[model samples]
Target: MTQATAPCCDANPDPRTLRGCCIGLSVATCLLFSGATTAADSFWSTIQLHGFAAQSVIKTSDNRFFGDSPDTSFDSTEIGVNASVRLDPKVLVAGQVLARRAGDMYDGTPSLDYALTDIALIASPERILGIRLGRVKNPLGLYNETRDVPFTRPGIFLPQVIYYDKVRNIVLSSDGAAVYGSLYNDLGEFSVTLVGGWPVLDDNVQWTYLGGDFPGTLRPNGSVWTGSLWYATVTEQLRFGLSGALASLRYAPHQNDILGPGQTDIVYGIASLQYSARRFTLSAEYGLEPVRWRRYGPLLPRQKVTSEGYYLQGTYRIRSNLELMACYEEGVADSDDRDGSEFAGVTGGLVPAHAMFSKIATVGLRWDPTPNLMLRAQYQWNQGTLVLSQLENPDFPRQREYWTLLALQVAFRF
Candidate 1:
């Protein structure tokens, strides 16, 4: 599913601007059910409606991220509404519509984030099995499922190393079905999930893989297979998970194109761990993706490389409503050439070695003035430019190897 821009429901150019109307719709839906008779109250009780909106201002000493950050950009925004309803004791339906704007990567086009019908096939106090059919969020790492929701995230920005915003659309969600199971006992709880689907792809995915969009179309060659295994302590103080995916895509070139028809195969995996206490939390996730490109001719010959990313982070609550966070993270475009020296040499210095890797250290503060309002401020020191987007920073050769960034955000939810 390629999410193309479309005219708004109203006459507005961007759907994000009509968020108020969407919220009003939510309110109206709730009110309409408020007058339900006693016989119909059970159905109304099963309905749940919620929405969230967030805006952020970002400034960077150099380079572009989410926008022309060097000039103090406010190009990042998120707005969405989600609803869920129980159709029966063992059946439920849920969905979300979202509008997001992020520099050159995403426009504020309204899109279906997810829509799914979940059915429990086997239910018991100690074990359960279910399946979800329709569009569903991929359970990639620890955060991909709720990546766009500010209220559910630990910070304004998740670690770029693991969540590449430039190609987010490729991994955000998929259209198909997923089977999941969970078991509970005194030892702990264990869960497993398997999903087969076609993920939504967009221009960002093309740019990230092909360097640029040629006179051709990129489409999924087949369905993607993703799986995850997780476990948590009995006290819910510790948890860990292993997740992975296999995906493939093909290119159909034009009559006289610069490239030949090519195929891309990707193998992705992530390991996550976390520990939580009364006021402090520690977490880490490491990811590896091996990409193979084939049949692309001389200009882009067959090749394979494994990229790596990982982060270590900790958060401490200063009070019931305030928290402080610190993190260190790194990303390498190719594990075999961690310094990108071989890559730079092959390109004759046309691209710098810094373009292949990045290291960052960050500190931040988050304050919850109320249950529905959140404010956050963060500062980051970054080295290298691996995560910078080509669409947003055309002058890639001139990109600085070191930079600093500061961001402030406010979010509201209901």
Candidate 2:
């Protein structure tokens, strides 16, 4: 997944960095293979290596998304390599590196997506418990943990209302620790995960929260706390999940800065459900976000608001290797100002009311010609620009209230 909250550097990546990452991945792969062949029964045999690469072409009838879409763009691509080694029966080490390019949001920087040590506390047929240390993916909604892997995604793009790409860095991954446990029984299975860590903060976070980059610096005020609980039926036909997060940040002022030191707190929660039959799957998720800002001098007063988002999606397997999908999603930046009238009024009409919310309807097709390859095409009708990021579309005033997008992608995994 893209960094959910952190705003890093320029969107255009350095050529040196891209080359280094590719060379590093090649070296790592060779070393792993060499060790495996050197000692089949040794530690090498416990190693697992996997990777995936995907490229997408996107076009839009109006409003820019994932590049200059009106002119047709190929700015969306993802590549990742991961490896795991079992050091002992109860211990394992795993890591992954990812390079992603998403229009002006990301610059194909090769970054360590995750590097963790997993220690099993308990292992049995009925129950299991474990702890992960190091940078780990924040287990948010159903798709967040695995969003970076195209093969694992149900569609070319996730429901942006919930798995938003604009502020993805804010909740993408964390550095710290996590505890997970699972219980299995005839009736159903229960599972839970708790995470305490600091999110990767960057300029993008500033863009998402503060609107733009300030002269001063912004950093995590403290650890972010996230948790999730899930339950599934015996046959796994029905599943439910509840997840939430508490995140905070602080900003320091520079001399002569327009703003003073301030703090921002976000409280978010979501409920997810999915039901699967032999050929079709139905899924839905709803999320609420309450945000608070305080002590930002006279220009920015203490304020709070709750935003809401939800989506309903379904997919039908047309054949052994093909599927059809459709989804509808909506998001409101402020439930109290769902139409943005109040917000726009407060801004003295500088911002349009339509900017406060977004709605999207989509239809898509997925085909698997080979076990490791996937082809997808999707069409989206959208209303509102609430989901578009300022970094990608700097000319906010020129944004359209309604737009349509078409996307096609090819992916391969091993």
lDDT of 2 by residue, 1-414 (tens): 010112334432233233333433444455446545645575767889999999999999977788889899899999999998865667667888899998877878778787777778999989999998777788888889888899888899999889888787668877778999999999799999999877776666677787666677777899898899999998899999999999998989989988789999998899999999999999999999998988878866788878899999999999979999999999998898888888778777667777788999999999999999999999999998788876676555677899999999999999
lDDT: worst 10-residue window of model 1: 1-10
Quote the positional error of residue 123 for candidate 1 in Å.
2.4
> Candidate 2 regions off by >4 Å?
1-42
List, residue by residue over 1-414, the lDDT tens digit for candidate 1: 011111111121323223423433443344335434332546668999999999999999999999989999899999999998765667666778999999877877878787777779999979999998777788888899999999777788999899888788667877778999999999898999998877766667776777666667778889988889999998879999999989998999989988799998988899999999999999899999999989988877799989999999999999989999999999999999888888878778866788889999999999999999999999999999888876676565668999999999999999
lDDT of the candidates, in the order given = 0.82, 0.82
Given candidate 1, what's the lDDT at residue 72? 95
Q: Candidate 1: deviation at residue 383, Å?
A: 0.3
lDDT for predicted candidate 1 compared with the true structure: 0.82
